[model samples]
Target: MSAAEVTAMPEGRGGRMTRAQIVNAALALGLIGFGLGAWAMDETFLVTLATKVAILAIAGAGLNLVLGFGGLVSFGHAAYFGLGGYASGILAHHALNYTAMFEWPFVFEGTTSMPVIWLTAMAVGALAALVIGALSLRTTGVYFIMITLAFGQMIFYFAISWPAYGGEDGLPIYVRNGFPGLNTLDPVQFFGLVCVVLFAMLGLISMLARSRFGLALQAARQNRQRLMAVGIRPGGVLLVAFVISGAITALAGALYADLNRFVSPSMLSWHLSGELLVFLILGGTGRLFAPLAGAGLYIALEHLLGGVSDHWQFFFGLLLLGVVLFARGGVIGFLAGGKRHG
Candidate 1:
């Protein structure tokens, strides 16, 4: 980033943090504090909840790159998400069973290593996004949305029909994947790992938004003609963003699969794609930390409301409507005092 860009960022007046910075700091630190508190209390479930927020936040952040910045309403992001999950699940399955993934392809074996699984998941997501986005980007508006959704469903059905792993029944990991020197079985340990990754992703995203390519992305979104006049290709920029989005979300899916010790078609379903969008909208579309805020609010509300009422989504839907209508900046924007575009 240029010195001008770095200097232009708001750090607040009189040596104080900006409102958005304060809120962003709280969101990041608060999740760590909450997880630690849960660990102190031996509340494994709550720790898991915090981890879920971090994972979902990662997923939401990825989608935000595409929808919030790239101006692509991808209703099929779950395709990449589930692909990542299955990637993890399948690798773990073969590793545990002492079987080769395929006899062909140089006799490659599965792995229980978290790092390996994450890399593989991200690659798969990126590749899928490349092909799908290439085709889907050919259209605009609702046609693009439908095409993405159609691709997602095709993946979803393929997962169901393929019984080698689990098919419609889903595949089980049996045991959580391994991380270097960490007790993967311990909720707190896993939560710590996931939170670290989430914060790193947020930082990377923040930097990307201020980078040259990031500026081009926004320009494409705001004015394709203007970006084209500047000799920037909107299609290429958007496609890159879409692929990056898929890869990040897929990483989250892999972590999620590890957390749950299972993989299912549900991960690839349109419902999840919609829920991700809801998280983005709820947290604030363009906000740097919107994913965490949105997913945290969503899971919190679901937990609180589900205990009191079975039809909790009805109330949640109403709240979502309110956010869409009034809180365009989402929870972060509402609290931080800024425009989504700003």
Candidate 2:
């Protein structure tokens, strides 16, 4: 068959493929092919890497809610990350020990249910964001950045000093959390779970971006005065965005904790917050799937470079610096050509 015929056949079999459809199909095939290859070699490392990509992408999506859509540059999202992780770790510990979380007013017991843990994490994260966003939103520019950073550091130190859950030592999740019938310990199963969460978050964010509220949030980000003059409260818009962003990031934290079967204060550190920001920039902020692309590329680079040398991080840093200086749009922009707005 001719090249055109071969291409058309794949598209026809794929059922009316658009650009996105073709890209997604290619990605799916690539992943399936890679998984089969890994299985052949008795290796699951790539599966783990893909999980990392999904988890990070989830966090990046949360960040994108604020940074990309709301035009808020928060330098302290690691606070939510660490908070979500600690929430899971603490609950799992209490449940495993069959102990009550607190006896002051009411009884709170831990369970192995993923949904319950995720809800708790999201709630805690939203509350934290509400408080932080309230204070941070009072300022703009450098002051806003500094305030967010301070809040993040505050949580980081608190986690380090808290004697519970091993304090600085971190807590281990002895068993993978249950999700109905799935054996989460299985790489493929866990990977599937991650993919589901990532896609769900992507769909939700995409919908939000197209909603009236999302438009207001974007308007507030671009020109707060104009939004206010148009009868929209910018502060309210920002607050909602911040809360949603935190919740999404928190969800990611829960998954990440399960992925490693552990939680540590380091998860809430400033470095992780910076890394999330880096992923957004690297992937092209505001693009729906930029985080996924960026996370995949970052993890792949880390894996390949680490295998090559011990000082790979230094090279990674240099490469990132080059990207920042020269590449205005990042991986998605490079792949997709230019930015498109709705």
Report every candidate's CA lDDT: 0.89, 0.81
Clash count, one per candidate: 0, 0
On lDDT, the leading prediction is: 1
TM-score of 1: 0.95
lDDT of 2 by residue, 1-342 (tens): 111121223333445544444443454455545655665676788777777788898999899889878888999999998888888888888888888999778887787778899999999999999999999999988888889999999999888898877889999988878788899889878888877898889778877776778778778777999998989989999999999999999999999999998999999999999989888888777766667767777888888999999998898898788778887667655665554321
Candidate 2 — what's its lDDT? 0.81
lDDT of 1 by residue, 1-342 (tens): 111222246444578776777788999898999999999999999999999999999999899888877778999989988999999999999999999999885887799999999999999999999999999999999999999999999999999999998999999999999999999899998999999899888777777777887888877767899999989999999999999999999999999999999999999999999989999899888777888999999999999999999999999999999999998878987887765222
Where does candidate 1 clash, by residue pair? none
- Where is model 2 more than 4 Å wrong at Cα? 1-41, 104-106
Q: Model 1 misses residue 7 by how many Å?
A: 10
- Total clashes, candidate 2? 0
